[model samples]
Each structure stands twice: as structure tokens, then as C-alpha cells.
Target: MSREPNQRLAALMAEAGASNKGLAKRVRETGLRHGRRVGTTHVTVQRWLNGGGIQPETASLVAEALSSKLQRRITPTDLGFPTAASSPVAVAPSYATSLPDTLDVLDRLAQQSLDDEQSSGVLLPESEVNSAVLSWLISHPDTLRVDVPAQRRVGMRDVAAIRTAGQMFMRLDFLYGGGHGHKALRHYFRQEVLPLLSASYSAKVGNALFGAATEISQLLGWTAYDTGNHALANRYLLSTLRLTKAIDDRMMGARILSNMSHQANYLGQISRATQLARAATEGGKGRATPRAMAMYAAHEARALSSAQDHTSAARAMNEAEKHLERADSAEDPDWLSYVDEAELVGEFCHCFRDLGRGPESLRYAERAVALTDPQYARTLGFCRMVLAQSQLLNGELEAAVTTAGLAVEGGDALQSARFQRYVSDFQRDVSSHAGVPAVQAFNTKVRDALADLDDE
Candidate 1:
């Protein structure tokens, strides 16, 4: 029914010097922006070259994906389909709704997420409409309509679909990781989403898209961070920060910027960290939820720690504490409840450790360890690791070794290379004290774990 998917894919392949597998990886990344999980295996990218028609509905995704990576525009018809609109004459109406409604939808979706991982039924009123979008997001990135063309009626339905795709992109990128399939995402953001955002985001649709993109971009940055692609992560963060104005989703932008501060601190860009954190603090000046204020303060403290500004860091930590007390008073931001007291304490412990204030670090670390609820397993693991590291340096090798084991156990459930890197760092620290029996045992456990992973 459709012509060949597009000449652009083949042409673009030539430009990027991408092999079949590379292209496959890119496709998976782009598909993720729409909440699909495509991989870099042979079958998926191969299907496209063979003219194995894709579902028509996913053409936008394909178009977005190709356009972004090649640094050029791509079309749906270029991918072997009719355009998103039928006949090109009967087009969907431009949706320019209020910003508040868009955010309300986002808020509602996040609330529903607590109950369901693959969340839905919160954004749209029509069950059928929400369900269709849901199916699109979770499906394989390449498994969509190149042949079975379907015309979508634009309205609440289209908005819901877009939001759903955006959310899926954010969540999956965080869970499995952004590096797993990122080229595709980079392309989609550059092409499909950018143009749409540029054309006319209603206060309504614009805010939603802005918020969604901000979240997704942060996830992309996280992937960059994890994979040690600092330049790429910084560039993405800069780009997303530019979108903060038009987006009107203050909380999302602030949190993302705070994340940038985190990355900057990690990369030892202390001035940049200070700027970003301070800016985020300024951005959310009036509406300070405990989470938001704490996030901002955490950023500031991290920056100060990196600068070795202990006085300022301590002050910022105090400010963070004050702000956290207000988190319950303000409305919850989508991603920030994860930044609770335990997280604050963990951040504080890290700051103190960096400043070489061992006793204070230990105090906060113990408090952090005490706060580890089962649901917050990841945060708890990190805190314990911090305690161990500080203890090791403070001449408490036995206690450090003990806490380090708990940290490693906590990390076992995470399956992250970055997490593993932290665990490995602690292991390395423990091994330096090989004469200590507990340290030797800890070293043995980590060495064995590394070997096990290698054998796999």
C-alpha cells in the first residue's frame, strides 16, 4: 500500500557512516521518545532496508528519528507513508490551549504513576483514546504502521497520545538507561518534537510538550553522564535549559537544571554547578516545595563542596533543611518526591566528606542509613556507601567494610554500570587496607562479583 519507507534512511546512513547495527541503535533511541523499546539487533533495522512495511502510525517517529541523526529534515512519506493528516487538505486543527491544563494533565499522570509503572487513564477522559496511545508507547519502536495507515482526529486524543509517548520516553530511558539506545532519541528530539514545539505550542500543548521534552532530555543527559559522555550531557542540558522559558513547567525545568548541577559537580565544574543550582533556586523562588527547595539546596551544596566552600555549603545545607520542611506545604512536582529527607542527608554526607569533616559526614550518613525504607532502596544503598567511604578514610576500616557490604548488596538489585562503578570504587577503597581482615573479605566479595559479571 505504501511506497518504500523512504530514501532518506539509506541516504542518511551514508552520511553518518552508520552500519546496520548503528542505524538500529539510532532507531531504538528515537522510538524511546515515543515510549517504545526498539533494540540494535539485526531484525528491526533490517526490516526497514528490506521494505518490510512499518505501521503507518509510527511514521512520525521514524521521520523524527532519521531527521535528528542525519542533521536534516525527514518526512513521513519519505518513510513510505501518507502524511499524518489524510489527503493533506483536511488537516487537524491547531491546538493552542492554556498552559495550566497541560500541566494539570502532567500532574494527573504522575499521580497515576504511583499506582502503575506503565501508567495511563489519568490524562485523557476517553478510554479508547488513552488505550491506543498506551499501546503505542510500550510497543517496540519499529513495530508500527508503515502499511496500516490510520488517520488520527486531533483534539484531546492527540494531546494524550503525545504526552503518553513523552512520559514513556522519560521513564524507560531512566530505567534501562539512555546509552542502550540514544542516537534515535537525539534525532527525534532534534526533528519531530522540536519542529512541533516550534510551530505553535498552545499554552496548553506547548507546556505539555515542553515538560515532556525536559524530562526526556534529562534522561538523555543521565545516559550521557553514566556513559562518561560529559560533553554530550552538558550540551543536552544547555539545550533543555533554553526551553525553560517557553515551557512554563517551572518544576520540571528546575529539577532538570538541578540535575545539571549534579553532573557539573561530578565533572568538577564547580562554578557551573553553582550557577545552575543558584539559577534553579532562583527559578523556583516563590513556589518552594520541600522537594524543590531541597533539590536546589542540594545542588548549591554540591557546587560549594566542589569549590571547597565549607561555610557556604553548610549554610546551603541548612537552607535545604528549611526548604524541605515546606515540601508538604507546596504542591508536589512530578519527579521530586524522590528527593526526600534521606536524600537530603545523603547529599549532605557527601558534601561533608568532600570537605573532610568526617564526624559530621558520619552523623549524617548514619541518619541516612536509618531512613532507608524498602521502597527507597536505591537512595539507601547510596547513603550506606557514603558512610562506608567516610568511615574508611576516618580510620574506621571495620565499620566501613561492614557498611560497604550493605551498599554492595543494595547495588546488586540496580544492575547499573554507574552503580557498579560506585560499588567498585568502594571496593577499591576497601582493598587498599588489605591487611584488615574485614577489608580483605570485602575486597574478595567485590572481586568475585566483578568476575561473575565478566563471566556472564
Candidate 2:
């Protein structure tokens, strides 16, 4: 079938006084800045002008390039492209300034995510990540008057129930991965939690209610991340930050920033990841508990290592350890109770693994594995992958394969896309030693494991 010409794009280009070659050049330069290799040429521009469809990713690049040249926002729709809500490069939802507005956005996001299964594969744009982090860093508390007259009254008990349910879902996420109960969690939030936002409640109860909502938002973001719905994860995280701002909870704000940083790092936005992590540390400074601070610092170290800044990474790791040493679990919020010695060490293992510090990473990976409980299946699978990679970097090919096989076995029980990515990464790493019998056997095991997962 023939497609209509992108007349809107042509008009925009004419208005901006941009030539096909110039616009293509700008798109390539923009992609390079974002660490993407865009190969759009003037011929491709002509094809688009002739009503040829552009890929969602390239449409974003074109929109961005034109927006910069024209000094205005130009969306994909403006270029006559159908809106790609699930596109990895789609613009993110802007930060909301009011509590009701934030709740509206959250409700919409949940509904959209539930309706569209493709939301699971969307990537959060780098610009949106930076914008949300910066906004949270500078934002102040909005008025907390949530006592709207509703048929149902929201009390502390209602808030407590929300918290309890959120905690239960969180535990399930940690153990079986995000795919386990993600749909149920979203349903609970939409049906059970959002209604309370508009219900009548006292000032004290309102603040606590928003706080509880923030925790649930954060968990939703995390599980989305685990299940590979990165764009949806970012939306939830942005909402979480907005809720924190309404409650004036600096510690929660910092925690949300850290979560955003983790997603950034996972998506290869190293600079954005580092910036968000630094913001977390700064925002959490006098307000966060010792364990929380340690978690922030560990994430910073991980980003630094990815950037190949060995010295700064080590320094950040040491800072994290020092904070961990001072942490008292009794003072920690229930949400942060999980960050202990094992978690910090797991961060250490990742940092060293990224920096190619084989021996140190191997030791930390081993310790992390030993310290992690059996119930935390997802975390254990990740730790094992790190150990296997560490062994490979140390030239212990046989040991690496053996460890990798164990990791695959553990992964059999996980419903996480992140865990599968880890398995793929490990498989790629060991491919260099394909001649080895152990490596070959491990490859077979991974293939079988993935097949079983797909069948399920």
C-alpha cells in the first residue's frame, strides 16, 4: 500500500529554512551526541518527503533536529507520523506541579500500560530522565490539602493497608521478578489506591497517604524496569518524585532519584545516570538514613565505573562502605530495610566487574552470593552472573562456565527480562572461549533455559 507524503514535515522544513542535507546532518550530529549512530541521508530525507514512513526512532531524531532548528517543540504527530507511545525514543511526560495533577497522570499511565502490552519494551528518553531528575532536585513541597469531600473516608488505616499491599507486591517482585504479579499490582493501584487520593482525609492522614502512594509508585517503576518496560517505568518514577515533592519527603525524593539513576545506567545513559545519582546524594544529604545514603553512593560508584573513571568509582565505593558501616537497620524505613551488607557488596561486584578489576570483583561477587538469601531469587541470579563474568575476566574459563550454568539454573525460576538479558550478556562474554567443552555445555544449558521460558 502507498502512504501519504509527509507534507507537514516539508512545511516545517520550509518554515525553518532547512535543506534536506542540512537536516540530515543535524540528525546525525544529534544522534552522535546521544551515542547513537544515525545514518539518515539526504536521500532518506527525500523518501520521507515522498510520504515514506519513518521508523519511530528516526522520527524522534527528525523531530528533535527540527525542534532545535526552529526553536520550538515538534512532535512525531507534527511531522505526520502516527504517535508511537511505545517508542523507545518518545518524549516523556513532563513533571506535574500539583498533587491532583500528578495523580491524574499516574492513573492515566497505569491505564495506558494496562491496555498496551508493548509498554514493556519502551525505553525512557535521555532528555526526560535528566529533566525529571533536575526537577525533583529543585522542587519544593506543594500544598497538601487533600481533604476532598468524597463518599468514602480515607484514614490512617487505609494508608496502612496500601502500604501493606505494596510491601507484599514488592516481596513478590524481588523473589519471582516483575512479571510475576505486575498486572495484579497495577490493578490494585488503579482500583484500590487512586480512589483514596480523592477521598476525604485529615491533613496528617493525607501526608501519610501521599507517602504511601509514593512507595507504591516507586515499586511500580522498579517492577516495570525489571520487566523491561523502561518508558513506563520512567513515568511511574516521575510520578513517585512528584508525590514525594507534595509530601516534602527529601529522603523519598532522593530514593526516587536513585531509582531513576539505576534505570539510566541500565539503558546506557551513563552521564545521565551519574548526574541523577549525584543528585540523590545531594538531596538525601541530611535527611536520608545511613543505609539509604549508602545505596545512593553505591549507585554513583556503579555509574562512574561504567564511565571508566576507576579512581572516582573506587572512592565512591569506599564512601558507600563507610555509610553502610554506620547503618542501623532499626532506624531504617521499611522500604529501605533491604539494603544491607549483601546489597552493598553486590554493587561493589558490579562496579569492579565493569571496571575490569577481575580479582576484586570475583571476591565481592562470591561474598555477595554467599550473603544473599535463597528467597531473593532474582538478586541471586544477577549475583551469580557477575561471578561468572568475573571468573571469565580472570582467565578461569572452566570455573566461569560452571558458575554460568548455575546462574542459568537459578534463572529458570525467574520471570524477569533483566535476568534474561544477564544470561544473554554472559553467553556473549563466554563466546570468546567457545572451543572449551565447559563453555559449550554452558551454552547448551542457556539455550534450553531460554526455550523453557519462552514456552511458559
Candidate 3:
């Protein structure tokens, strides 16, 4: 069977400044380090680049050679080669059978996510996502290994450091968008968190440490989603689910499922989104606080609205509203702090908009805008955009233009690809009214703002 060229591998080679002959020689040297006399050459490298299949061991050698040159971890997956992670065996029944296996997967995924050159435009198949969710839902947690042989003996202080760093990264992500600080966050995870995971720790420390890791992994997934690296986001989320399960954080695991549902809805996998959201809601029954429960219900409403399940969607939205009214922040996980009134209103706006309830959408959108904190730039921008869309749908073209203009102004500061899509969507929605003075002006504003964003 003819295969497409390995653009991912080619991109990595370019980034490593490795020519065909040079990379082949490096691969051979790496093989020699493993007690193998591999006969790799420029021809072999060219063939590999041209979509010729490589042995798994040879692929590892290639990855090792690139990692040595780049001074960072490079797995076979990063080079678009089939690894245990991608193969049927790796993802077949579950994510992994042990804590170390989960860590291995997380390490490889973090490396792949950090390599923007390699991961750009790559989206994993929906089948893979389905498999991941299924595995998480059915698989039991592996045996926890708190006692590990390593240089450092970790404690609560170390776990607190990891949690603090993750919280800081989360704040930055919320404020400036994922593209703004994703690289630095990934570097922190690899440099700071990775060592802690490998260090000696008691069960107490391990639970706290893994909890922090779960938070970081979830943020990594969210940031990846914001930056349009959906496949990487999916991988990170799966790792997070594994971590949550290992730590026996049932509520946190439910939250991860809710996030997966949101991503699935965004990807147009309506059925899967609904299933995942329902799973989250059911699983969170006894474990989640009201605020966390609200989040799960809201995501379910989102998927239901997209699927046009009007009655079911309304029921879920009502449930979300009720939960939010009783939400006690102190009782909820720190990660769920962002899912406050404004966030719930935003979800309501989204559901109404998707359900074609323009008037209701406008109400929720306006409330979302009013309730949103200015520091949350991306959320405010999103609310404004939703308001503009609702206005346009309600035939208030001038009002739509004004709202869209504000969206452009606020959203342009964000480095998020999703925010850019919001701009594009509003622009497309308003393109029909281009003859109107306000619409034309808004169009001009969009053009200038997008140009500036591109230049930056």
C-alpha cells in the first residue's frame, strides 16, 4: 500500500537541523549505543521520509538521535511513528496497567505536545478518542507505587510547589490564552514536575503529587485545545484521567470527562459529547460539589443543544442553573473555581445559541458579559461574540456590529486560535450586511485587527 510522506518526521528533522545523511549517521550511532550495528544511510532516511515503514526499534533509535541533538525528549510518536501509545496494544483495553506505564505515556505526550513543529495540524481520529473514553470508564486503577527509588525524597512541600506552578500556569492561560504561555508551561512540566513524579515519596505525598499532576495535565489539555492542537489535547486528557483514577479522585475524574465532552462537542462529535457528558454527570453524583455538578450539567446541555434535543437540553440547563445557585466555592475543588456564575451564564448562552433560541441566547449572553471579570479576557470576548451572534440572529444588525466590534477589540489581544475562530465566525455571520455602514466599519475593524494579530 502506498503511504503519504511523513511530514511530521520531516518537520522534526528540519527543526533539529538534521540533513538526510546526518540524521542517518546519528541514528546509526544511537543504534550502536544500544549494542546494535544498524546499517542506516541517507537512502534509508529518504525512504523513511517518503513513507517507507520503519521497524519500531529503528524508529526509537531515530527518536533518540533527534532527542540527543535537540536536548529534549523526542519519542517515536513525535516523529509520527507507531509506538506502544499509538499501536492497538497500547490503547486497546486501557491507557496502561500500572502507574509507571501511565507516567511513560504522559512523558511521551508532553514531549509531543511541546513540539509545535511536529504537532501542528495533527488531529487524532475520533475512534481513538472513543477508545480512550471507553478505557477510562471501564478500567480499574492500577496498583499505586508511592515508594520509588530516586535521588530526591518528595514531601507535601514538593507537591505544593507543583500545585502552585500549575495554578500559576492556569491563571496565565485564562488571562492571555493558551498560546501566550503554553511553551513555558510545558517546559515547567517536563523540567519541574517530571522529576517529582520519579522521586521517592510516601503514599500521602504520592496522592498529593499525582493530584497536582492531574491538574497540570488537565491544563495542558485545555491549553492544547485552545491552541488548536486537538490530538495533543486528547492525549493529555487521557493521561489526566489515568492520574485521577490512580489517585482515586472521583470528582476530578468526572471533571475530566466533562472537559472531554466539551472538546467532543466542539469537534462536532455530538453523540460522543452527549455520552461523555452524561457519564460525567452520573459519575459525579455523590462525589462532586454543586459547582462541579453544574459544570457537568452545563456541558451535557451544550451537547444536547447541538444535537437539537430541545427538551433534554432544557432540562440539563435548568439543572445547571439550580446547581450553580447552590454552589459553595469552599466546598469545591480549586480547579473548579473558574466555573462560577459567569461561566455558567456563558454555557447557557451557548446552549441557547445552538438551539436557535435567539432571544434567550441574547439574555444569557448579555448576563455572561456583565458577570464576566475583565481579567478573564478570553471569556469576556467569547461572551461578547455570543451576544453579537444573538443580535444578528434577532435582526438587530447595527447592535450586532457594535457588539462584534467590542469582541474584536477584546479578543484580538488573545493568542488563542479559538478566539480567532470566534472572530471569523462573527465576520462570516455579518458578511451579508456589508452594505450597512456599521457592518462595513466592523468589517474594516476585523481586517485591521486580524492583520495586527497575524503580524504579532
Candidate 4:
């Protein structure tokens, strides 16, 4: 029931001075940093210690902790195999095929299932495999096609099933943010999903299948971004962009590019970020509502501000505000259904916070937090951190520290690398205020968390 010799676990724990809680907390935190799902705590740890079981994610975590502590190679086998599972559900391998076949597989499903599986309403005569079928599938824009007609394969699923998968991912993303959602979706991409994308399907079916892939890729991109895999995140983002173009979802495409801009700026690729933001705005074409336009402009403003171009920033800011005004007067597209008046302030405030415009940023930060959904714990956590930074810079030490503490509480409950970076940044700033009691308290807490992470 153990991977490495059981003797080592106790020895390493004693050498590192980590209690079971401390070790588990550290493992969970580090697991998150490396991209893993680690829900359940005391009970899970109890089971593992009581020779229950641990997943590959847990194995990797234990391996990481042991290697660091013992200065030697270690792996999941060192922990325990427990009858050898097929794989960790989070890191399943991938399968890819061309457009039509993938679509055909997704659109094919059984009748009267809870999954409501259905294939393309039109039957593709298996006897004739030609381009005509492909063209017809694409030209027919109706949602009537539920399952691909009459094809049977274990890997093949109905459109409804694909949609159900999408919904599942969307729900997880909503509940846990992309950080946790990415790995789950990635497993799908690696296993039953991506292989289909590798095959060649007719253009019509291909596009439909591509549409599903695009959403999955978008989620993958989002998860990677949220988990701090910048390079992989950008790769998935670009893939999503290309897929959206093939499927002609300019709105979604533009949104992905806008997000890319943020990532570029984060990585200090200022010009690239600016260019991408501009391209995103342009890509939106007439689809950009006042709100969408404003949001897009704000993304550009954020990039420009990062590059320290005040003139461009001002111009972009003005245009963004104008766009926001227009949004107030216009009917938004379905994709932009979530954006509203408060979101505008929140977006601009976020850009300002990043630009280090303390007072103005604080105003926007407060408004955004007030307007943001409580379920969006990560966003709220980042907002609180922004507010803390502003307050700290403005000499409101007590308020800053208290706000930072709240951010910590919010952060602890979620798994996000960006939030961690935000905390790290806050910690760096507070280090300069070491003499203050609030700063001291905050630093102590951060160190404790960091230490716990080290133990894992």
C-alpha cells in the first residue's frame, strides 16, 4: 500500500518537522501550484495515512515533497500503488482526429438517455464518403442535429453528451475557477476528446465538431491561465483563436484574444499585448456592443498602461469610457450578456489598479468588489488585494493590513496562482513596512503559509 518504503515517510516528516496537518496542507498547496485537484482534507489525509489510497496527483505531490526534503528521486510508487489504477483522472492522455470524424463521433448518441444523446439529424450514407456531405452539414445551421446518424463507436458520443461535458466544465469553472477546472478538462482533452479532433470529417460536421473543440480549448486555455501555466496557456489561447476563426465565432475569438493581451502584459510582452488587444477589438467588428467595446478598449488601456504610455492610456481610457456609455444605450449580444454598468467600473478599476494609480484604482476596486458575484472568490480575492495595495500605498496601514488579511482568507479557500502572485506582490510591498504591527502580522501569516507549502 505504499509507493516508496514506508520507513521514509516518517523519517522525512520528522526531519522536516511537519505535522500530518502541516504536511497535508503543504502537499495540497504545492499540488495546486503544479496543477492538481485536492478537495477533501482531514478525512482524505486520514484515509491515506490509514493506507486508504492516494491519486497520481497526490503521488506527484508526495514525490515532490520527498525529493526536496530527502534530496533524492521519489515517485508515486514510493507512496503506494493500491492495485494500480488506470490513471489519474486529471491527466488523462489525448486523442486527436480531423474535423468531420470528430464531429460525427460527438453528434452520434443513443435514444432516451439522461444525456439526451443525439447525432446530426441528417444521415450520412456510410456507402458514400464525399465532400458533398461536409458542405451540407456546414450550410445547415439548424440545431436540429443532435446525434450523428447511425454511426456506432464507444468513443463516439451524441452532441448532447458533448454539450453536457461543456456544461460540466462550465459549472466547475464557475464553482472553482479555471485553476481547478483546467486539469479536469485537460483530462478530457487527453483521453476521449482530442483524438477525435485528429481525424478528418466533412467541412459541415468538422465545423460543428470544431465548435465543440473550440469551447473545450477555451476552457483549457482558461484553466491553464488560472493555474499559472503562461506558455501553455498562450498555446491553448491561440489554438482556441484559430478554432473560433474556423467556426467563425468572432465574438468568442475576440474575447480569447483580449485575454491573451492580459497574459502578454503579465509576462512583460507589452507591445505584443497591445497588438493583440488591438486585434481583438478589430476582430469584434460590428459585434462589439458599447459594453464589449469598452471592455476591449480597457484591455488595450491596460496594456498601454503597463508599457507606461500615458498618452495612449489616456486616449484608450477615453474611448473605453465612451464605449461604456454606448453600452448603456445599446442591446448587448448573448456573449456579452453578463457585462453591465458595474462591470465597466470594475474593469477600468482593475486596469487602474495594475497601473498603480492608487486612489483612482481604489475607487474602481471597491466598486468592482461590490458588483462582482460572491461565487467568484478568486476575482474577489484579487480585488481585495488590489484594494489593500492601494490603501497601503496611501498610508492607511491598519486598513491595508486588515484588507490583506481578508484577501488571505479568500485566497486560502481557493486554488489560484495569479492570486498567489498577487499575495506575493503584496507581501513584497509590506516587507518595506516591517515596523508596522499590521505588516508584521501579515508577514507572519504569509511566512506560515509559505512554510506550510514548503513542508509539502
The models' CA-based lDDT, in order, is: 0.59, 0.82, 0.80, 0.61
Q: Pick the candidate with the highest lDDT.
A: 2
Instruction: Give per-model TM-scores.
Output: 0.61, 0.78, 0.79, 0.61
Candidate 3 per-residue lDDT over residues 301-363, each given as its tens digit: 999999999999999999999999889643866788898889999999999999999999999
Candidate 1 has what TM-score? Answer: 0.61
Return the lDDT, model 4, position 232.
53
Error of 2 at 184 (Å): 0.5
Model number with the top TM-score = 3
lDDT of 2 at 272: 86
Report each candidate's C-alpha RMSD, comma-separated, in the order given. 14.6, 11.3, 10.2, 18.5
Quote the lDDT for 9 in model 1.
57
lDDT of 2 by residue, 1-456 (tens): 787788988998998898999999988986775568988999999999998877887787687677666543355666888754245452236675456446645765666553365455555566766676777777667765555545778889999999999899989988888878888888899779877776678899988898888888888889888888887888888778887987789999999888888988988889988998999999999889889999999999989999999999999999999999999743887898789899999989999999999999999999999999878788889999899899989988888889878888886444888988888898888777788888788888888878888897
On residues 67-149, what C-alpha lDDT tens digit does candidate 1 reach at each position? Answer: 56543335555555554413221111111122221221222222221123333122112233223223322333211111111
**What count of clashes does model 2 give?**
2
Tell me how far the alpha carbon of residue 350 in candidate 1 is from the true structure, in angstroms, after superposition. Answer: 1.1
